[model samples]
Target: MDVRSDTALRLPASDVSPWVGLIGLATLLSYILFARSFPEISAALGFENDLGRLSGPYSALLAMVLTGGAMAAWSVCVEKVHRNPSTGIDWDRRRPVADVLNDSITKLAGLWATWFIIAGLYCLGRWYWDGAYLFAMQVMGAAVVPLVLLSVPYVIWIDRVMDDPRDQSWHFGAMLIGRENFDVELVKKHWRAWIIKGFFSAFMISILPSGFAAVVDSDVTEIVRDPVRLGVLLFELLFVIDVQIGTVGYLLTFRPLDAHIRSGNPFLAGWLAALVCYPPLAWGVLGNILQYEVNTADWAYWLADYPALLWLWAGWLVFLTAIYAWATVAFGIRFSNLTYRGVLTNGPYRFTRHPAYVAKNLFWWGSVLPFLVTNGSMVDMIRNTAFLALVSGIYYWRARTEEAHLLLEDEKYREYWDWMQENGAITSRIARLLDRMNPRKGMSGAVQPAE
Candidate 1:
């Protein structure tokens, strides 16, 4: 099993099996038709409806339907592009919209079936452990376990079935040290001359006031009295500190001996849109364009009309920031954009493919509530919606470009990309949309291979 052998390196033959699409379609149809029976199904399983007004009987059903549709769309896209190894006419050929839509519907059925089994298992768990704490734990486990079971086996199957018989040694652990060639001269040169240095300088200057304000506004005595408050404060501090460390590390530390830099997206729209996200640049460009700053209002003010949800809003804020910092910690010193330090499959990375981007975007949407801030004017509503959409779209572009870069850098990344497509529990709507936009394209906005 010589992994480097040319004969073994090529992709395997396509599995254009009709049964796959048929099974998926059947599963999707079942869910959509039986959605009304979800409440009865839950009750029969001994699971109580505790979400109350926040989530009605139809809520779970609707969520499941939407999830099924998204999963189906993603599955079909991956199959159309990556699953078929035959790279000639079929590679460039575009299937008719009707055929694509049918395939997607079929995948939705497969996804729905998977969720159905998971829900049944969740019900079984509830029957066993009826306590609130245990029920909550079981609910979380149920959400994740099915996906892991389905996806992990798929990854292993792909590896075993691949023509190359991918070397186990090429996994994430091997990526940590890389090809050990520690060039001291190169490290010094990079530190002395890099655009990242200017970014670090600007970042520090920008974060200063917010960092200071976190400390200044907190009441030490009050924090000490309440454990929950103390925990929240500590999370905020850790978030701030981790972000700074990540910024510094991006420029000053964690040098890879053997590095591969991917070509940047040439599109002005992608880079320019992404640039306005950071400070100094944001202050210069976005500050002028935006009439009101999003962060000026509290989460509760924008989210819930009642003051009762303040604590809930605060909790969400803490959760969001913690996840962001968790991602930074996972990356260690390899957190730069448009570059591959190495493949990271541990920590938060293990949970989802792009936890940082997803979490950051989630936080922004939750905190900003752009549509909620109408301010008694149609124009304001439109403006806020447009602004947030632009910001979100930029991040989406960032994710796409980064994926393109990684896909070109190494075969290992291609393997990872495939695994994520099959098994990753979370899906990015933006990523899916981009793929839909050009299903036949290898990587949108052409990129140069790593030198």
Candidate 2:
């Protein structure tokens, strides 16, 4: 019998260096910690404490700049991502302004028109004017003038160095301008990318202030006495890290740092799976329609009588949350849903293809303990567990679609997938177990990046 070595498999070469994300993670943590303790620092320095704590939405917004700037600087100064062919930037092939003027104008026209359409959609979408989204709409509305004004010179300058000055946006511009030829496919691509940015960016920005405030204003004095308190605090902190870095990833699609969205996931199934997990759709499905918490009490309530078990369960939940956060950290500045900026094979990804999904599902299971219910109804127990399982299944579906998209789009992802199947410490074991159950089955199949 052949024996497999006990040692861990060699991690595949990561398309994204872990350093970029790690630097961002470190910078983000530094800013968050400083924000958390700003009041004390202000008084200690003999400065007026009029501003109180820097835990507001504006502060949270600034954190994105600090963390993203750190990652971008590292990608440029250290990794030299600008020179990578993937960036589509050719610094050596600069053309005179006159040559690219018309092309730049077309691109600018396309971009401005795209932004205007986004604004129109925002107006039509009732969700944008209500609740948390109000802040996001306001911020975006405030920036429309500046963005339109600034696009002129910015487009002309960048167009000069672009190897192919007529990109997807340019195609869209050409269609509108009516003088130049444009491809229908490229126009679709432009909308796909912009739609992703407009939709997800607003969602991300909307949720930022609430979580940041929770962390900043949290009174942790009782945390030591109660595992529930500690767990909630840690969970909020980890999520804040995820949202802050993730927002930056969505917003900073600049070509200079080579962090631009190369392609949005073209698969309709991919979009459906992702969209169902967020916003108006989720508010209906996951929030109410399929609400799994109907008669369920959390791990804390179940274990309130047993202090040891409560703490243990809380710690487990926190560990899972940490894993989820680490998965985002690994992506660094390239973290976004429904798009392939690059493949990541480092950090928690070295362990599994979808650490965030796994961790998130496991966290829900541990914290909710859907099996145990306060109502003690067999019906409730069965219903809650079943619904949670369906929720996990949704994530599994999302992961499969994402893998299919990536495998088709990039050869690098194929190598990563195969490597994980054979050598990933956790993934390999899981794959083998699944194979045993369904011997004829494979993990995931490749499909179109878009429809």
Candidate 3:
């Protein structure tokens, strides 16, 4: 027999496909039925019954069941479309829906898992400590809701604005969940870079004594009662916002650059380096650790004293704003060359090449100063100074490394550097001071001198 006749002879008939369809339908129905009654089951198990009266737990359960059924049906429809080879589902046509659905499900699963873990932890803590669990829950709930409300929308907005619709395949959601042609080497390189950056950033912000109280011990109630401590807590919260925003921006912009430098041992070297460096850098080596015990009304008390901290916060905000603006402009310029897309770059970057990093360092110093000045502890002073030195050194080395990379890639960058040098626009003083202070040579030999 010919090949076509042989293949047709071996093929299963359409009647056999009904079994697959039946199985999908059963799965959908079961999910719907269970989901519809979930609320009542939850209430019976002592979960809060806040889903309303008439449309209560049962309605929610029904909705869940229906959604699952709908998803299964959608999948079946896709399979049916794919069954016919000649006029079947095309990659371009099928991909977007699959990607979106896959991304949504993955995100939902992650969110649910996180919530479940947190709730479990809360229950465990409550059991261990009398009255402490209830207090912790309330405090955590209060802090969490507001922060989520404020930050989530802002994050979504940032993502939307920064997103290039043409490059949707490059998105984190797509890369992780969709069947895109991903570069394994590129993913590994950028993953390492992000982990390094994120670890350092997290340590700097969270290694404070207050962080330990709020996170590990779960003593939020005690921290809220003291005015000074409350002030520090609020500062920490804002600092978190600044760091997260900057880190996200940096990752998006430099992902391609990191991806270009992939190696077989990417994770091994980077992970080891981060683990070795972060502990001493965050805890022992750095100065001025802010400590707090959890207290009820801590957030309320902190808000009340906002007027006093307003000026300092204002300065900090200004510095952070400048940094973000600089990043936006500079990265915009660099990205423009790739796609010939233009963005406004007339402000901060016009003055300094790496103003964002400089401004961020300044912001850190501003945050550290209030505590050192007010508390006036020698240990705190020394710690803060050490932190400043370490951060500045790191920033200096990074800038030099980045500039050298640019020098190799772009001839125009050399002109820009030369112009800044001739115009005395770049400040090399900080880099010089760092070099003098360190006995060992940095990764990059000389500071490219700030331009």
Candidate 4:
């Protein structure tokens, strides 16, 4: 097959069917409904429950389980993802347990060592013990024993049927034990994937409880009358959806669902771009050094006098936030910052390559109104706008590094890249604008994204 042919290259069918995301979304919505009505139901049943709302952090954790389990079941039963070639499993070719027993033992050794290193890093990072991360640390501490005990059986069983059981974990083990020749690159890939999972998983889990609780306990009586209040409530709800769905993506990287991390971004630039946008580093750099919202009055402040404009602007911001959440939902159980589970060509992706980034940056600009300062200092206004532009530029750089990683990782991503250049609605227009500016980009033969 000529993969580069126009007929073959045009928008390939989505690797992840949209139905996977829908099932998860449906499960999440139902959970939210039940959480909101729990108090009323408890009272009707003459129960003595006194919490008044299902706002516990554990309830939020349960939301992740429900959403993740539903999506995994759908992937295994409906999509038959377990049968996919990428899983590296051949159910019909099971080997004698004794044949792969040594390999499984070595692999388990590497897996245990990797977990220990990750746990050490978690303890070393001070942020993990502070603020929202405390819950995450508690959860990890509780899972330590269970994860260790379950790894033995799971590793042994999977190794017996795997087409070739010497995977990345095996290579790492071989490197450590000096039992046989091990590829240097495979060991690096193994560590890279685990490091990404460790770092982002903590951040994602740390954020889940607060947003989940907010959505469940939101008081909408007063919000129903005020446009600003209603808008903020909606923002909280949408962000909870995004965080819940995205957290599931991080937690459920199981082979049966074909959602394992194929690779993590290898470039240092990718790491810097992503890390600086999150906590600790972001707290110092973007929040303090380049603080763009120093004297800014947000959308509510500016539009307070104009009631009609206030309502319209609030609605506009809500729309952008919805797009941000929708982008995460489109990933189904495959969403993560620096990994590729599959090529997504449906939903908001069919229009723009980076809908989440674009919407997120726009949301910041609209909500903060950074250019319109309260003190009316021209220097402050210019500084605010310029810093915000720099923030957006960072997202652009992140997008580039991601495209470069995926371009080299899979041909499907390359095909999607080419297809978007020709047929994507927003992507095609952006590509044209860039071409008009460079006029030499086509001759380069390098795949660059409009993101």
Candidate 5:
């Protein structure tokens, strides 16, 4: 068997790298030490001088940072091990920290400048109904929304530019963008088909959270505030982490009999869809419960406050869903190398070639609907709508860039495009409607029929 195939088939070593092991050990030690002296730490930090209150939030934050750091370190180690041993991975030794700092500052400055412009617009609305609630919403929309949206594109750019040469693969490229070569025709051909698949996949994955909400009677906030509910939340969070790590390991090691066929790694597209939808769904459910539990007059307050949170949450959902859907369709089209994965492509794919993108837009809108309708604030609605538009525009740009690359890399994609055009399967009025509804503007207007 080829080396890549062999590596894929063999199980990853049960033993982690020494560095990872040490980091894990250190994290555990730190947590333990900190937990033992929580009272002292809380007192020093001037946080109520109560260990319990401070411990949960403090430990959770620390754990998140440590866990994130360890994952980054682990990725680095894996890349190093996979590199050729003879020459070793070359370092950009001459690259200075100052250069990196400058680049980061430039990106941040641009992001902040855009944010300030939005803030000015939001301020215009606030002048009419200036209040504490409006102020809070304005702060969040102006500051947090821009920061998160900016990070999404920046991260994608960074990943492509900074990815290790050795880890570059057809699969990785497809995963990052819709097509490895970035062929618009090929993407148009398969977009709707993938969207149908993604929608069902997303719908199925949403069952877990839905089930959790159905079974749990108490409000999520109440539950979270309680020790047991908090514990359950922690467990759920840990489970997600474990699932993601395990999925990565599985992808690295598992080689199916056919290389052309992509495995449905739940962690990749499916899990991502779930993660995007579940939190807001959970929060929405919780909000409902809280609304019910509280007095009638207080309902407006919770609704307004919670929906603002949901707006940000929805923004994240839309962003992640778009990326995930794009990756899924791209991977299936490029890596699977299958002409047709069964011919019942009449649902999502029938509308357009890229259904996942469509679904992502819907998901975002769904998350934000509660906030928009509940707040009755045109400012919040317009701000979110604009942000969504910006997101879509960026993704469209990314799609176009990827399509160009795909046309060059994959000849099959050309045939796929031709077939789609010939068969009247390329685009539809419904698809165009969906595309227009997409926050991303200036997407391709022409749709080719599938041959």
Candidate 6:
């Protein structure tokens, strides 16, 4: 047998796996670094001593990294078994389920070791920064332990259902970088169990405090005195409601693998670039370099100058949140970041391929208009604009990455892409503009299909 095939049949030596050690060390060092700078991080994000609000999300964030890193290690081991095979022994071939279970247990043990070490280091980091053990214990017990337990099945299921080794496989790209296997039926059936493991967990942990703060700030008894403030408060309340509905809709309809071809890996550069857009990760060192606050000096001061426009801003916020919530609702349970659930051709998706992302970015730009009018330094304005552009670019990257995965995995996506090319509201307009500019010879002669 070829060396590749040999690697497939033989089990990986988990103890000698270099990546496990490396990941463990890296996780330890990163937590230490993040810990050392936790105070600065909180201050930069305007939390300071009020870090209590962030503890839950931050713990979740750390656990995610730990789990992702461990799962990546498992992928590395399994990927070798898949190199250049037709479909390396999945359960369809009647391979003993016990053997598969044992293999999963072995990989899980190795990954668990890495996670345990990182959790310990994270606890130490938390204690070192705040001189508090309560949060540290919570982080360890609540986040790390649960993630490890979750990973046990996560690792097993991927191996059990997705051990097939089709060349040019859907998972090849993601597997190269150690991503969990893609299995639509498995996920669709079991997704309820996963609602908490994914974005829902973060959303739940983060949104509650914001909702509470909105309630704390608002005085519903005297709404007429400041209609603008009232409008803003109502928008906030509605925004929270919209998010809750959308999040639940996402979990309820969570059919992640319905059209999943593959997905970007956490270890990939694409994943890293996309990850820096969100908080906890974005609030740290990586974001320090890439992130720039808009010149809100304009927004803060301009809001007073343009009282009427405050209503407009509030309206935009409400509209933005609504459209976003609508888009998520459209996705139903399939809504997620960086994974293909399926092609959504109805609802907001029919008008444009990326209604949610486009609307979100537009809202950010419009909402910061007050800031845009401020008398900030020219360089500051440029930096802020550039940062926003970079942020936009990251989202663009994510859209394309997801498209690539879907297109590679499913022919249906290609058909959808073609249909959108011809008839999509936004894309057709762009295509016409491009055609007009380029004026390709003979292209105009082709009969256009009626939408």
Model 6, residue 34: what's the lDDT? 55
**TM-score of model number 4:** 0.95
> Which parts of model 5 have CA positions greater than 4 angstroms off?
1-250, 253-351, 370-376, 421-451
- Tell me each candidate's TM-score: 0.47, 0.93, 0.34, 0.95, 0.28, 0.55
lDDT of each: 0.47, 0.87, 0.39, 0.88, 0.37, 0.49
TM-score of 3: 0.34
Q: Which wins on lDDT, candidate 2 or candidate 6?
A: 2
lDDT of candidate 4 at residue 418, scale 0 to 100: 84
1-451 per-residue lDDT for model 2 (tens digits): 2223323234457768889888998998898889988989988898888777788888888888899999999999999998989889899999999999999988988998999898899999998999999989888888889888888888888889989999999999999989557999889888889999999999999988999888887888856677889889999999998998899889889887788888888999999999999998999989987788987878877788998988888888989999999898888888899998877988999889999999999998888889888877999899999999999999999999999999989877887887798878789898778766764443453221233
Positional deviation of 17 in candidate 4, in angstroms?
A: 1.5
Candidate 3 overall Cα lDDT vs. reference? Answer: 0.39
lDDT of 3 by residue, 242-340 (tens): 332222222222211111111112324323333433453334333224221111122233334685565445545555754554343233212111111
Query: Candidates sorted by TM-score, descending order?
Result: 4, 2, 6, 1, 3, 5
Better of 1 and 2 by TM-score: 2
**Model 2, TM vs. native:** 0.93
Residue pairs with colliding backbones in model 1 are 24-106, 24-110, 25-106, 27-109, 28-109
Error of 3 at 212 (Å): 20
Winner by TM-score: 4
Candidate 1 lDDT tens digits, 292-403: 4443354554544644565566677678777776776555333455445556655665456678877887877776666655346666767777876766677777777667
| Candidate 4 lDDT, 160-243, residue by residue in tens | 878878988999998889978788898998998898888888988899898888888888886787989899989998998899
In Å, residue 147's CA in model 2 sits off its true spot by 1.6
Ranking by lDDT: 4, 2, 6, 1, 3, 5
Q: How close is candidate 6 to the true structure, as a TM-score?
A: 0.55
Candidate 6 stretches greater than 4 Å from native = 1-140, 143-208, 211-218, 223-227, 238-262, 265-269, 279-281, 284-295, 298-300, 303-308, 370-373, 376-383, 439-451
- Measured by lDDT, the strongest candidate is 4
User: Considering summed lDDT, which 10 consecutive residues are worst modelled in model 1?
Assistant: 253-262
Q: Summarize candidate 6's per-residue lDDT along 1-451 as a digit string, tens digits.
A: 1122332333222211233223433443354345445567788888746443323334434433453344344424643422322223343444455756755654565445444544555445433234233433444466666776687666655566555422122233233335565444433322322322243334333443344345334556787456466656655654543443333323332111222223332224445655666544666733687555644543334576677776666666768766765665454323456554445666666656777788878766665642262555777778777777777787778777656666775555666666665677887687667656654424544433445
Which of candidates 2 and 6 is the stronger one according to TM-score?
2
